[model samples]
Target: MSQHIQRSIDSPLRTGLNREQLWEDHDKGLIKCWEVGRQRAARFPELANQCLAGELPVLGWKGGVSRSLKKLEKFGSLKYLAQWQGLRGEDLNIDLSEERELTCSRTAMVVTFTPDRSKYFNQVAEA
Candidate 1:
């Protein structure tokens, strides 16, 4: 039998299209799903630690299930800034925008963030 079918047969008490509903029901009591800010901080463990330790100001979450690094900037979180530094090559071309200068003391990354040229301008205007 398929793995999914075997799991369903083993747990006949699960009462949803899948086990996700059961998991969500159980997790709801552990975390405040309505508190978007706390959820945003949770995505970045460093920031989440600050939140649990009672830091000033806070990050906000919106637009989708995931938090946006740019939006979190208003709360003074710099996790993205550190990640950006990793993407720079030996020549140090780490500018995400024309006017921004970034420097990280760590080694460079092979992965880089490239704008979707066709939509970048439109998105920027909307922002």
Candidate 2:
């Protein structure tokens, strides 16, 4: 476990469960993965269902879109996109090993949900 997450778990103010208890539960398979887009599921059930069904790719980023865009400028588009996919896969425990053609266009933005009911985004590449 990351020190940051462990610290949060250890802190009484943040959580009542300790690190050992959480890990024990995880080892026993009592804990499942995290869910995304709960509010959107309530507001737009069809769209959420589609994403869950794999008809759409649920988009996300490593940090704030503003920060991600800055990283893209530093790393270049292809490398940035790979890093985004890699980090998200690790966080979500998803397998991204199956090869597929990936593209990063000149005009790209990371559109994310769940920011006070308003989308948070940043232009990835300047036009």
Candidate 3:
């Protein structure tokens, strides 16, 4: 029998994965998933961390990861600014216009915003 089948047949107590062990395993799995996400973000250094985090809300992208990144950039959450030093402007400017056009082609609405002094004053008063 396969190890998976053997594990399935074994009781939790016999297998040594008690409640605490099960919880630890669950936490480890979560950490592994988070590490994978971080690795992906590292591979695409041009994209913002917010873009990667937003993937969960949009249900894992379904082969639309590039589209999601463009949407984040369009909405101003992801800017052209570099997050770290040692990155050249020329290197980072890799066909962004084409990517943006392709990704945002199907977008229904694209909203851009700028904050005014009035909004800041209101926020200060509320705080």
Candidate 4:
């Protein structure tokens, strides 16, 4: 049973990334935060550290690692289809249309569940 802890959404770290540019680049599938970090590290690890420490700007965005990751998760190519806190917690159904369904729990237990995307998608298509 591993616990998925929620990380801080903000920090002193900053990237010189413009908000619009960041979103635009993400929308264009140019690159993701992880990729950006990898590129920065490859190019200049020291500068990357400075960017992470808020001593320098990166991609024109002023945000911490967690914030960057969140933004990437939201707009990046990756898809987080579902997230469940527990058996009692509400089920968050994320569909292609971004419509979320909040369904009450019928049992008690902190169990997070996520369906296999490929299988689920195949089933849906077949139906």
RMSD each, Å? 18.7, 12.6, 18.2, 17.4
lDDT of 1 by residue, 1-127 (tens): 1111011112222223344553244332111222223334446666445333323222221111122334232211122222222111111122223222221112111112222233222332212
Cα lDDT tens digits for candidate 3, 38-68: 4445575544343433221111311122333
Off by over 4 Å in 3: 1-24, 47-127
In terms of lDDT, the best-performing candidate is 2
Q: Worst 10-residue stretch by lDDT in candidate 3?
A: 2-11
Worst 10 residues of 2 by lDDT: 2-11
Q: Which residue pairs of candidate 1 clash?
A: none
Please give, for residues 6-72, the per-residue lDDT of candidate 2 as tens digits. 1111122224666666435532211211222333345666644544333323334322233234433
Q: After superposition, how far is residue 107 of candidate 3 from its true place, in Å?
A: 7.2
Give lDDT: candidate 1, residue 51: 32
TM-score comparison, 1 vs 2, better candidate: 2
Model 2 spans with C-alpha error above 4 angstroms: 1-36, 58-127
Error of 1 at 5 (Å): 39
TM-score of 1: 0.19
CA lDDT, candidate 2, residue 109 = 31
What is the number of residue pairs that collide in model 2?
A: 0
Error of 1 at 18 (Å): 23
